[model samples]
Target: MSTFGELFRVTTYGESHCKGVGCIIDGCPPGLPLTEDDVQPQLSRRRPGQSALTTPRDEKDRVTIMSGIEFGTTLGTPIGMTVPNQDQRPHDYSETDLYPRPSHADWTYLKKYGVKASSGGGRASARETIGRVAAGAVAEKYLKIVAGVEIVAFVSSVGKVELPYLEALEDGQPIGKDFSNFLDHLTREQVDADVTRCPDPATSERMKERIMQAKEANDSVGGSVTCIIRNCPIGLGEPCFDKFEATLAHAMLSIPATKGFEIGSGFGGTKIPGHLHNDAFYRKADGSLGTVTNHSGGIQGGITNGEHIYFRVAFKPPATISQAQQTVTYDGESGTLAARGRHDPCVVPRAVPIVEAMAALVVMDQFLIQQSRQASATLLAPLHTPHHVLQAKPQPTV
Candidate 1:
């Protein structure tokens, strides 16, 4: 269960407050040029103590590549990486020994395994994402090299401090003017320009204030991240049970604290009739077919349609807060428990890279699977349908 991906599999190890945490990546293509530099920037962005709004955990989150590369080139072998826990304070979590943190993994983990880590939330800790981010960097490198794919994620909302772009559109209403532009060319620098990572300067400021309010109150806030995957080739997702959007949803919801996942128009798409919500097709100047709109979120029937794939991931407020709450202990005795530890007041800011990483993993694995299928299918003779069968359903023109 710890492993993710089929061809580009990654199995994460270690835990919060343990010696360290990392992953082993299997099935990476051979001879790709990679180094610590490619992986470090994303990890640095995900690490703690970056700004006033985040936890002051003071971890460099420096990664050490143990194998799978020699002199900056992959050898078609498993890749290993690790990031040590330099600032763990197991003693800080002494209160958890008497009680399970509400909405955290403590109670369920104990009930399932009959034991749990004494310090941090064990596998439930956000620290567990270090391996995901690292492995994602590798998969992203390959995707970029082979298909020029690009992935970016940013905080879109922090407790209602949201961009106007995410607002649901009514029938005959058009998308926000900047929505397409934002998804098409937004850069990580533009996203990382603000501490809240919300992309809009004014909105980022509001999100920052919201997070600070929670930090000051010894409470926590929740928010959502919007991610975009551009330049994905057509026919990437598996239909039936493993649709592209479904796999993406699986990937996003797997992260710690994730509560919701929506692609394209998501829930709002349900408001309009088929005619108004449909993405009409058009012929591009280059003679290729394109959609006049992207209500499908760059996918059609669970496969990429050569448009930007955009989605949103919602994270719940961190449960491990310093605020005192009346809750039952392990033995059913109720008492006031105030948790102690360094945790993000709003996880969206730090969650941006994690979201991007998971997106890359999903895209890369799906790409490899589809690519292999196409390669094998190319060797077979083409299916020649009868003219009557093809004419039964008239296809539309651009």
Candidate 2:
């Protein structure tokens, strides 16, 4: 769907190689500090050509606020923004009209709609995520100010190159910092310092080499982006069908080229026995409940448990490649088509911001829903109180 979320709604518009792309953010709480500056960072991060690993196509991707703010503060109306498309080479995709790139959305989109945009994958292009990234920046700001929530994502793996797993501390002495510390100290600077976006310098080098190798071979590589949401409050999700993780999976998979989503123990937990997989709870030094382990990934029963919400998103390699391959044209005639265009040899690096954006949207949406529920219940809290226990008589309005 073009619109996402129940309370903090966001509707994205425009397409790849189009005039511009952006989003309308509705339901943003009033008086939150907001501006083009807040949204531009994520857009810049998602933009192509900043590094050798991504596509050469470069558009400043600068955004302009069209509505819904006054004096650098949100007005709680539908916030409209747009970023004009520049440097679009529609001619590069001219051949795609006749022959859909293998594994690309060209064919499926053409089938769904009788007519399709001749240039780019239209909305299926990674460029479509610009709006999401923009709207997410707004949501992120709200979450940070209201809840002290921090969201960050990085390229966790590229092809076979993977960072070492977060194993338990030596002899259960808690060698590593706890989830709060990890989230507190994990800054975007550390991630952006390297081209691969992997926090570890060594692993980032290997990941960059892998992307360069794919570019040299006229091929592509797939990888995963891991995101962490810290300081999220408990009870920020619904039960049953609308579980937090389920909605989170839906958001992550909505991004172009995304193939998988995993939270907490995810698939690996299946191998471990229940005892090892379960996160044991205890009272913390602050007199608050805490979990000794985080196998649950900061969530249990699909709700945030005040722990760090950690997850990974797997993205397939960008489908458009320079390699020649035999494929059928739109008319079913056999042909060999070699795609030509500026495309990322690997998408995981650019996907880091998109992953973080989507995470922020989910968290913000859930937070708003929970807040509304709590507010309504609290408003009616004294309605059913026992008459004998009432301290003072209710005052009457004139």
Candidate 3:
């Protein structure tokens, strides 16, 4: 269960305060022109200490490629990458050895494994996500080069602060200067311009203030990230259990502290009648098929529909807080605890890249699966040689 994907698989390892955190990515296409440069940006973005609002743990999180490539090109072998953990303070987490933190994996891990890593909640820490971010960056590069797919995720809401809900607008509707083009126009630069990573200027400032307020009060806050995937090929999903939305949900919810997952018009669509909720198909000027609306979030019947794939991930408040909390100990003895450690006052900003990474992993996996199916469809004859014909191999001269 630690690994992800059928093709383009990634298995992550290491813990919060371990010697390092990294992943081994298998099934990446060869000759894709990859290097540590292709994977580091996301790691840097997801690293702690990016701003005062985040944890003060200062880790450069520089990644080192260990194998499965040569001369800056992939060898189609498993690519191993590592990012050493720096600035670890294991002593800070000694208290967790006694009392399990609320809303965290401490107790569950202990119950399941009968033991847990004594430092920084071990693998349960958000620090474990570094591997996912790194692998996601590589997948994103592949998607960009081969499929022209593009993805961007931003902090859409922090506590009560939120950006404009642009998904509600009709096609070509505008909220601001050319806001109708947001699906294609929004860029990582615009989102990263602020600490909160919310593209809306006024809203970003408000989100920052909310984070600071939480920090000052010795509390934490929760928020959501909205991700948009554009230029995705149509028909990239399977029906029933492996629905596109279901896979996306699985990926998004796997992130640490994620409390909810929603695709376009998600919970909001419940208010609309069936007719309004349905995205009607139309022919585009290019004579390609499209939809007048995208309420299905660019997917219909579990398959992509050549429209932008958009979704939102909700992250719970960081469970570790400096505020005093009352809870039972490992022995079930009642106790009051004021936990101490480096933690984010708000996690949404940092989670932006993480959300994007997880999304990329899902999309990349789906792309590979779809490519295999499409390739098989191109066969002029049976994919395998017919048994009778194969059995008639020319008799070799003795």
Candidate 4:
């Protein structure tokens, strides 16, 4: 189930707090330029201790390319990559095996597998997502070069300060009039101005104050992320089996702490009538058909319709709060457990990059599938030949 896609499959492996985590990408086109450098930047964004708001665990998160490339280009083989755990605190999790943390997967995993690793939630840890992000970077690069596609994701809500998109602007604007513009407006000093990553100077300051209060109380908070995909080609998804929205949902939910997902008009459509929800078709001045509205979110009948694709994902607060909580030990005895290891007070900001990465992966995989079908159809086209010239040429040769 970890493997995804037909023409552009990727399989991720390894565990959190383990020796390392990695991914193997198959079906990548040969001779595409790729290297470790291409994937590392995204990984750095997801690594812990990158900012004051995130966990204090310092992980370099350096990526090592193991195979599938020669001289910085792909060999049309499976690309293998790994990132070592440089700052593991196995000691912090030694007691976790004996007393599984409440609200965590420890008990469920034990019931399912009869045994589980003690260190850092084992495979269920958020650390498992590093491999996913790294692989996604590769997919993103491919999408940009091959299809002119771009994806952007940012924290739209932290607890309650929601960053709404501007109504007049399209989703793909270089600096869309909402959070995108806010991000652009801030300088590097402004970015470091707040721990919550909110672009509003005042709002960011207040969010930081609230997070600090929660930290003092040994608690955590949750929020949401909004991602936009631009320039996706129409007719990219297979109608029944691999709808674009379905694939994207699968990828997004695979991340840890993801609780809710909604595409265009999702639950909101329930409040509106069919007429209000439907996207009206119109011809543009450029002689191209376009939709006056995007209630369908650039997709119709499970296929891309070339409008901007956008969605939102909600993440739950990290379960490992420092406050003492009631829990059952491995022996079925009740005990009080308080998590000791480093953890983020809020995970939404760091998750922005991961969200964008997963989106890129889904889009790039769908693109490859679309391209393969097109190539096959092209090869099947009829060819024309000159019969008279062929007969005369044969006679002259004789």
Candidate 5:
């Protein structure tokens, strides 16, 4: 249950206040170069205490590679890794014994397990994501090498302060020219330029204040992250089920606090008529098929079509806030529970790396599946149909 993927599997371990947390990545291609340095940078980005908007847990999240590599290259076996929890504080969570924090996983976890972690949310904690982040880094490296894949995610909204262009851009609009251009050319450096990670200098400053306002009031705020995957290989999704976007949604929602996922036009596409929503195609300079509009978000019929794949993930305000709440204990006794622990006032900024990592894992897994299918198909003779007919526009199969 802790693992993900079919061919490119990853199994994560450890808990919120445990000895450490990490994952084992299986089915990685051999001879690909890998090292702790490649994995550490992303972990550092997801680590707490980096900025005022995030938690102050003070973990270095230093990763150590245990196996599946030799001389800095993956050995095509299961790659095991771990990150120590230096600042773990079980004592800080004593209040959980008397009361279940409202909107958190505390009560449901206890009900399901009979005995939960002695401290904190245990497996439900954001600390659990340490393993996910580490595994994602490995997948990212492999994806980059094999396909020049570029997966980048950034904070697009914080509470009510949406990115300037995105404010009027959603809900049946043409996804303005500015946002389209930004998605094609934006880099991580531009995203990291501010702690909020909103990219626009002025907008990012506003997001900072929004988070500070929540922190000052001992409350929490929610936001969304927009991720784009460029140079994605064609034909990576499965039909009927297991669509590429479906897997992406599954992966993103698996992260702590994620509540919503949307791809391409998402809900915004609902209002438009079929004529405007459809992506018209044409011949590219490379003599391949291309879409004039990207309303499809680089996918059609549940498969990739070679354009950029983009989506947004929304996270609810963290449940473990410093503010007091009226709630009942596990015994149904009433109490006023005020949680005590370091938590992000706004998790959107730190979530940037996590989103990117999960996207990489999805792409890495889907790519491997598609690659194997292609290899299997190559062994047989070509179909009797002419090659030109196969390349022609959509044919009537129904």
Candidate 6:
């Protein structure tokens, strides 16, 4: 099932070495401004050959809009978008027609379909994600304008390195009157200077040294990504079938090479007692509810509590290692295989944007659900209140 969500659904199609890949978005609200231009930036972020650490497949990934829009506004119909594959080297995998790459989907795909596309893992390639990222950008724009929510994700860990919480690093920093500007000036290269995205100078250097060593050896490594979503409104999920966390996990795990996911305290919480792991609630000065500690990761009972949504996703190393390894052919003949291709030594750095894109997709779906249920005038009455209330008066001399 390529489609996801009951409302605001999206279905993706195409193969790795095919002429193009695309997605069809259904249930998008009518009159929302959308265009191919709005979706291009995010696709560029995930396209191959963007940097030294990604696959060297050079694809321009130019997107085209086939339908569902006119005059830059969506028509509440299915929106179809596609990106043509500019640089395709299908001949690279031609020699392995009968042999399957170890740890790849080639064997299973053949078994499931009786035949498989021979070019670059076909639909299983990370290239399929191009469509998802494109559609997700549209969802993100809608969420930002209509829901007032923000989602940000960065490479928190690569191999053994991990970044410290942003709040902790900002403490005791002496910035002269412009804290936001100070943060904005920090580049990814400066962050990478520490190795684990940790912001701790010493620790990051050690992590970078480790990565450099691995790169020299033609080896690869993997790590985790942390995503933080802020300003998510309360009550944005279904209870029984499609819980917020479950839907989120499904969306993330669907990404190629993602191995594991955990929210809040996650696996570590199991070792601690309930008293220690539970988030304590309190009333704020503004009379809104708040959690003293977000050990529950800003979600409780399958619903948002207006707190930051934090989660971590673990990714495995790239499978296309240069080292020769043992493998078998389609006919069960054993042989040795040495991977030959340009691939990432570590996928963590590039995965940061993918994580943010998936998070945006999940949040946008939830926000659409929220809008549908609260469209009634009575439910939206409180949202129109003024800071200073004025009493109602009788009309006179009209």
Worst 10 residues of 1 by lDDT: 389-398
lDDT leader: 1
Poorest lDDT segment (10 consecutive residues) of candidate 6: 172-181
Give me the runs in candidate 6 sitting further than 4 Å from their true place: 165-207, 376-398
Instruction: At residue 386, give the lDDT of candidate 6.
Output: 73
Candidate RMSDs in Å, in order, are 3.0, 5.2, 7.2, 7.9, 2.9, 7.0
Q: For candidate 5, lDDT tens digit of each residue in 87-149?
A: 988999998888888887888888887878878888888888888888888888877877888
Query: Which residues of candidate 3, in runs, are more than 4 Å off?
Result: 166-180, 381-398
TM-score of 1: 0.95
Q: What is the C-alpha local distance difference test score of candidate 2?
A: 0.85
Candidate 2, number of clashes = 0
* Residue 305 shift from truth in candidate 5, angstroms: 0.7
C-alpha lDDT score of every prediction, in listed order: 0.89, 0.85, 0.86, 0.77, 0.87, 0.74
- Write candidate 1's Cα lDDT for 25-48 as tens digits: 999999999999999999999999
Which candidate comes out best when scored by TM-score? 5
Q: Output the better candidate (1/5) by TM-score.
A: 5
Task: Output the lDDT of residue 299, model 1.
Answer: 92
Model 4 CA lDDT for position 147? 74
Better-scoring candidate (TM-score), 3 or 4:
3
Q: Which ranges in model 5 have alpha carbons more than 4 Å from their true place?
A: 386-398
Each candidate's clash count: 0, 0, 0, 0, 0, 4
Cα error, candidate 4, residue 313 (Å): 0.5
Residue 140 displacement (Å), model 4: 0.6
Distance from true location, Cα of 239 in model 5, Å: 0.7
Worst 10 residues of 5 by lDDT: 389-398
State the displacement of the C-alpha of residue 333, model 2, in Å, after optimal TM-score superposition: 0.6
Q: Looking at candidate 4, what is the lDDT of residue 185?
A: 38
Error of 2 at 276 (Å): 1.1
